[model samples]
Target chain A: MADGPEEIGRLIGLMARLPGMGPRSARRAVLHLVKKRSQVLLPLAEAMKAVGESVRPCVACGNLATSDLCPICANPKRATGTLCVVADVADLWAMERSQAFQGRYHVLGGLLSALDAIGPDELGIPKLVARVTEEELTEIILALPATIDGQTTAHYIADALPELNVTSLAQGVPIGGELDFLDDGTISAALRARARV
Target chain B: MADGPEEIGRLIGLMARLPGMGPRSARRAVLHLVKKRSQVLLPLAEAMKAVGESVRPCVACGNLATSDLCPICANPKRATGTLCVVADVADLWAMERSQAFQGRYHVLGGLLSALDAIGPDELGIPKLVARVTEEELTEIILALPATIDGQTTAHYIADALPELNVTSLAQGVPIGGELDFLDDGTISAALRARARV
Candidate 1:
């Protein structure tokens, strides 16, 4: 395809690199931006620039922040004596979206993956341990995925902080999930973790 | 949802307004950008700023360009005595991707719509007619969609320039399209425009 212009082509190329965006979708997005230059493109550019300049990783947790500590960590009311450990910022955001967790979060950046050469040091597990020891925390919630690597990381963190009450998110049928459509593993997990009426 | 930070929240909001993006996808994309700040966010921000500051609609056609005249209009070799008119810049880009058209393009910005109160003047149909007369163009190809509004706009343009040879993109079975899966309208069009072997 004929690259429209140097800058436009470059912009499309960069946009295509974004997660869930391909060349065709990137082209559509750029077209939308160009058409609504004053409304969408300018504001998005300004917002991105502001975030690029101001946003940083929270010093305590790995959550994104404009300051040394993220908003959750900075809020005084969030000190619930609990820290939710997640595999990444996405998971942390997911947890926040559900409005379930009341405490701060520690984003491991990723789970333990032997194939990817990711270890405890790479995921800031030592920092996590340090925080648990330094703070008056009583509970460490492992909100990681149910994948093998996620389980391994949870086990590792649990072993490292035996003193603190470490618990993981339960695996079972989702809130609106139907029993028939559920996979075998989910069904088994639900049966195993069945609660009393 | 708890707005993460002022800048981050603003970024997500702006991203959510883009084509093919919603609140959830915007949040996910923003999180991805924040996590890979150096790799994706920073560069994307810079590229967006560059495009926002430099990109503009070409004066002759509505195609995006860094200058008053677009690259196609500026190129002497592109003066193929034929002009292809499309509804938007995206259609022009799609035509370019096909690499079949060697002439110039005239983006109508949008089609004529009574419901939306859009007319010939709004779509710069007069400007298109003037360009055809002044630029020594022999043919005008209406490369609009096959929808009702698209056909109405095409008919309007054809009537406006009766002195010139006017045509539109053919409607039939798409390349690599299957007969069994084709819709009724498409099958009828293909049968009507059937070629002799």
Candidate 2:
């Protein structure tokens, strides 16, 4: 039998399934929620319910949305001609947090994975191609990972859209990165892409 | 502006308030939940709503309950004459997880802390005393922490119930604790409380 009430136990079980949470941490989180029911738990429940009921993938860019288009896509002020292609919505959010990119985005959902039988179609490459002409895109920025699959997906997209100016995020040693701790691949990439101050 | 839709951003903000979760991890969790909406997000939302609406403190023991008494207090098979006193509902739940305590529990809500102005009355010591005669309790086990506040509360409870047998959890090295890693206080306590095999 589970500890506490059945409702609480079920809540804990479901919470444990969330990323970075286990049974122990889930229990702690639940206990914390119970202690602050009005301040946290109730508000959280309402938010989750609202999101679950309303949120859906944006039809144009595949980013999460409440309507047909995402906030970035709906905003007219965003530079529409330059589209940033990301492997996932999380990456899109990360880019948004940086506030460096003022353009729209196209979420690929995932990269090409031969082992998993995931191809260009699965990553919405065709949709991206269609958007190029439909949205009158000038530049397409590839914000994909440096992994093999990511590179393969990038190459395929570039090959498919020969007319568009395609570019990938520059590889370099990160800010505050120590040379001793840097990987050989990263050092080489940084050296190759070195720019003048 | 927040990342993603307003509803999704709101959900992430609330999720960040949970124990062990920060803004970054909360974002990851929200994205994960969105990905598994039917399997995790919807069910989690429903569970939180159910728990928030139905769960309340047990009138008798202060443990979380859906009714007047908690499951332990409601169950007749549990030993009636033995009552375990814990500092919080979380502590009571931890004791239940051990499956070693075969008695009902009394939640103190918190321990005595002069710094915080918490005293016996605030911890429901009077209610516990009343339960002694009402439930015909013979033994009261204190499963409080090893902190100064916990010890002070234990002593206060012991003094309040002069007639009843009041005991505390033994202090020693944990079951898997190595002596080299054990603190001086624990080592001394273990040596003082050494028992014959």
Candidate 3:
């Protein structure tokens, strides 16, 4: 019954899958959502719907956008000669939220995981190289995770972009730490980075 | 640029307007959502779509459900001679997440507020009275908040149910403190109640 975990249990299960939310927090969150149907639940439902319909990956750079191209990729004023490469859109969003980095982004989708069999193709290194040339790119900034795979992906992309100026976000970004967790200020500091690899 | 907080800034603006979220937390949360688009955002978008299309209020209790009666109201066994009356769906969800209160719930939608012009009709007190008599209820537990309006609503309902049994959740449910914020254990402790009004 919906009265028991059997019925509403699905809610808890899905919530548990969320980051920072475990089985217990998931249960609590589901309860809270249902209880505040009008004031909280209904509005939340609407917000969810809007995001679902409108949210999509920016085709040009792999950043999130309501359109085919993310705002940065579409905006002509943004610095086209520079591209900040990141492992995921979350990292892209984190940098965006800082109100720094007037340049464009190229979301790598994921890192080069040898164990998972992910390599240059998986991380879109070839496309990145093409973009460096096509966009007349002067610099390519690596904002990848500080993991071994992340570092490998960065080197692979750097090696591919020999003609372009390449740099990495400072050692300031924690090892294996997702760029999402850093405060806006830290992201800005990392972007004013020096050359690497 | 995909590098500004414009959309996320707007999203954070809307999010900060939610019941509990503030500007700082909204900023952090938006960053999280944007970064985890594939893992969190895509799934969240799908979940929101499903919930939006499927979710509606139970005609009887105002609780969220994909069906007409809600799982709680439809069950014949749950039509047991007990009704747990709560001020809002959040309280109802709080009760549900505890895995307690097997009988059924009556979501009053809101407490009695004379100054705000809310009264018995506004809170569906008449339907509650009808449910008690029609279901041949043995007990009506007032799980309402203890705020002035919440207490006022409780007293009115209790008075209305003078001929039937009436009780209130015990000490664990604090005065004026919302049940949504209370953990499941506390809600369970209160529901394992002893006294009756």
Candidate 4:
């Protein structure tokens, strides 16, 4: 093989590090960029550059933007009093995809992992508390994953902000089928999260 | 919904143009960037920036790199005489993932499409031919898709590079199936690509 440019190699390496991608995908993606030089790659490169030079995160809500404030934070249309506390941006995104909740969001970078030494400070518990008071929030929707890390974080937040209405996202045996053949985990979860029956 | 920053919105817009992504997915991804500001987003933003600033395509094989050559192209170990000709870098990456071939690659960018007015030149057929003549090339493996555009491109390349030992990726009823239940296209392909049987 011949020596490709350093920047392209770096880009490939970086892309390779992304989840679900390796060196080969990075190379293919890079090749596509070159082939579509005038169209896809060039524009994409320009976009990447423009974003690199100007893009920043929102100081308040953790949404991406070209400035200190992301669009959602700047938007007046969002129902200010309702804050949806999410584990990560991906969960926040899932909620956004559903488009069910009209409230704004506060992204906790990750769950409180004792193994990783992530405590309330690391997970931004104080920020949520401050946000509750500053934003005059009424409801805090917990869209965290139903994992140990997620559940632990939810409980921490619920206890910390006892005054606010804290809620967790509902999960069960999914939308279809009977529970007769449900697994132990599913059955237990269904019973625990049961509405009435 | 909140308004994204101008450039951020623009970046999101460009991301939305990528395959398997919509405005909604783009928004979620952007939001992710915002939330993981110090970690994932910052690093990603910087990576995107660095690549944006200097990333360019390999002049010879059309793979992306920060320099004139990509890492694969730059590595002496990968100069295995054999050049795997692919329609795009994605396919090249796929082959790499399988770890099957040890040769370098030539990304054609696309297969010929008459409906879309694509031609040999559009896919850099001339460049591929030029590489064969200039480089001490060996076998030229054709790993194009089985789509109409892919097949048309294959035949065209086979005819053009007759001097090169041209071969095609296997076409069959696929790995886990009986031919009797195959579709018309599959049956036709299986017959056309039939072996001594």
Top DockQ model: 2
TM-score of each: 0.95, 0.95, 0.63, 0.63
Q: Retained native contacts per candidate, as fractions? A: 0.71, 0.80, 0.11, 0.32
What are the per-residue Cα lDDT tens digits for candidate 2 across A48-153? Answer: 9899999999998899999998878889999988999999999998899899999999999999999999988888899999999999999999999999999999
Candidates ranked by lDDT: 2, 1, 3, 4
Cα deviation of B184, candidate 3, in Å: 20
What docking tier does model 2 reach? medium
Per-residue accuracy of model 1 over A85-140 as CA lDDT, tens digit each: 99987788789989988898998999899999999999989999998879979999
lDDT of 4 by residue, B65-165 (tens): 56787677777888568888887656765777777887788888778998889888888898889888888677888898988788888889889987778
Backbone clashes in candidate 3 total 6
What tens-digit string does per-residue lDDT give for candidate 2 at B55-136? 9999999999999888888899999889999998889988888899999989999999989999778887888888898989
Off by over 4 Å in 4: A1-3, A52-55, A65-81, A134-138, A173-184, B2-9, B16-197
**RMSD, model 2, all Cα superposed?**
1.7
Instruction: Name the regions of candidate 2 deviating beyond 4 angstroms.
Output: none
Compose the digit string of candidate 4's lDDT tens values, residues A1-197. 23245555665675555444567655655554444556665565556556656766568977555678766777789889888888765666567767798878898878999999999998778988998899888898888988899999999999999888999878788778578777778778877888965
- Clashing pairs for predicted structure model 3, backbone only: A35-B89, A35-B90, A36-B90, A72-B1, A72-B2, A90-B35
> lDDT by residue for model 1 over B74-130, one digit each (tens)?
888885699999999889988998989999999999999999999999999999999
